[model samples]
Target: MKVSFTYDKKQVLQALRYHFLSRKEIRLMIILVNVFALGSAFLFYFKKILPLAFLVGSFLWFILMLSFWFFLPGMVYRRATTFKDHFIMTFDPDSFSVGNERGSRSYPWKAVSNFLETPHFFHLYFDSRSFFLVPKDSFSNSDEIYQMRHMLKEKIKN
Candidate 1:
């Protein structure tokens, strides 16, 4: 139940984009943010809101968005860099140990609040800012994949 694999940039980017937003969701979010900003601008135009405060608020929001964009690379880079150094894996149904690494930490499936199955990995979520990404290459065949998926889903539900 153990295998070693690497994620190339293409796979990583695809996985992140797919999980972060669907095309429709991205469009909706953009529309909502613009509408809100326009409404705020209209209020400022009519002197319904303080000009300085409105300007400051908009600037802050822009800054926050930029900050998020800037920090995201660091997050992705850190994850990619230390991905090998840190132990990354999930439990194996057959062994009842880490499917990706043994003699490491043994965590019951219930400990994870949920799991995200990306194309390349099983993202086991312990909490915000913490997770283990177990690559799909761990299983050699379709049956193993089926078993592992079933076991994980069954365990994660509780």
Candidate 2:
């Protein structure tokens, strides 16, 4: 199967956010920050801690959420030239290829460590920090998307 696609800014940002949140470390960090914030609030309400403690916790929580939701994605999007170009992607039984104006590259199934399905894209990961984003809208329909998902599942073990 094959498809052609160009990234939309909003969709790309959403995908980026999805990608980050999917990571174990990011999720842990968010949970930890929220826990601390809640703890601080609890203590403050019980008059067991000074107001400064609660204020600091709330500030940290807000900054962490803002960074994840906006700052990080914006910085990544701006620095990435990949999303700015059009791409032609072809998937075979054993491998896939991605082609753009600059060039084309092909990789075997082993090249992909895993894949993640977000609302708008298939986040194909080479590793935790590197990935290719294939927009779901590029597929002809739901059938193609299903086929791709099945193929990825069979090809990538983890």
Candidate 3:
């Protein structure tokens, strides 16, 4: 059988979280923080006229600011993600599937290693935390999603 589905970004992101956060997002955040942190360190180091206490305080303050800024944005960015369709995903029992935006990955159901579902999405994990998210919004109603959700509940726990 084939199951066709569509979803927006938030739903997809939630599904991905079960296995991994988007590398693009995490990497970009890291790069931003590192850049700022390095910049702060350099600024402080160059200010040779400053007191030793001021230098230590500046370093501590920047480190704290960097850590807080990094974590807060990640949390907020994640929690505020929207449900806009970046792609589509189709699954067939016969190892055929296609997802929009991204190219496609076709492998048998046997190739799938696990599954996870949250309140709003379905996750089919072919590897740990690496998965596709099928949003509940793709179904006609909560019941249908629940039914479909229950149907596959047994097939994956891997």
Candidate 4:
């Protein structure tokens, strides 16, 4: 099967957020910060901690969220030229290939370590830090998307 598409900036940014939060370390950090912020709030309410400490905790939580939700995704989107390019992707029994105006590359099933499905894209991960997003909007119909999902499950290991 084959599909061709370009990334939507808004959707891609959301997908990037999903990818980042999916990481164990990032999720853990967010959880820890949230817990700290809640603790600070409780302590401040009961006069167990000073106002300054509570404010600091709140500020840290805000910064962490702002960085992940806006800064990192914006920075990544600007830096990666791939998201701006139109792409053609093909899937077959043995391999998959992706091509853009500049060039094309093909890889066997083993090249993909895992895949993740979000609302808008199929994130094909080569490793922990690298991946390609295939937009669901590129497919002709839901059936094609289902086929792709099934194929990825069979081709790659989680």
Q: Show the lowest summed lDDT stretch of 10 residues, model 3.
A: 80-89
lDDT (Cα, tens digit) per residue for candidate 3, span 1-158: 33455455454444544334333565565567656556666666788434554556566656755544454435644674233334444544355465555466666766667666677776667775345566667676767776666656544445
Q: Model 2: per-residue lDDT, tens digit, 1-158?
A: 99999999999999999988988999999999999999999999999999999999999999999999999999999999998999999999889999999999999989999889898999999988999999999999999999989999999988
Q: In what order do the candidates fall by TM-score, top score first?
A: 4, 2, 1, 3
lDDT of 1 at 136: 71
Worst 10-residue lDDT window, candidate 2: 114-123
Candidate 3, which segments miss by more than 4 Å at Cα? Answer: 1-85, 101-103
Which stretches of candidate 2 lie above 4 Å from their native place? none
What lDDT is obtained when candidate 2 is compared to the true structure?
A: 0.96
Which parts of model 1 are misplaced by more than 4 Å? 17-31, 34-74, 85-90, 94-103
Q: Model 4 over residues 4-111: C-alpha lDDT tens digits?
A: 999999999999999999999999999999999999999999999999999999999999999999999999999999998999998999999999999999999999
Q: List RMSD in Å for every model shown.
A: 5.9, 0.7, 9.0, 0.6
Badly placed stretches (over 4 Å) of model 4 are none
Evaluate all candidate structures by whole-model CA lDDT and list the values in order.
Answer: 0.61, 0.96, 0.56, 0.96
Give the top-scoring candidate (TM-score): 4
* 95 Cα displacement, candidate 1 (Å): 8.1
- Looking at candidate 2, what is the lDDT of residue 86? 98
Q: Per-residue error at 119 for model 3, in Å?
A: 1.0
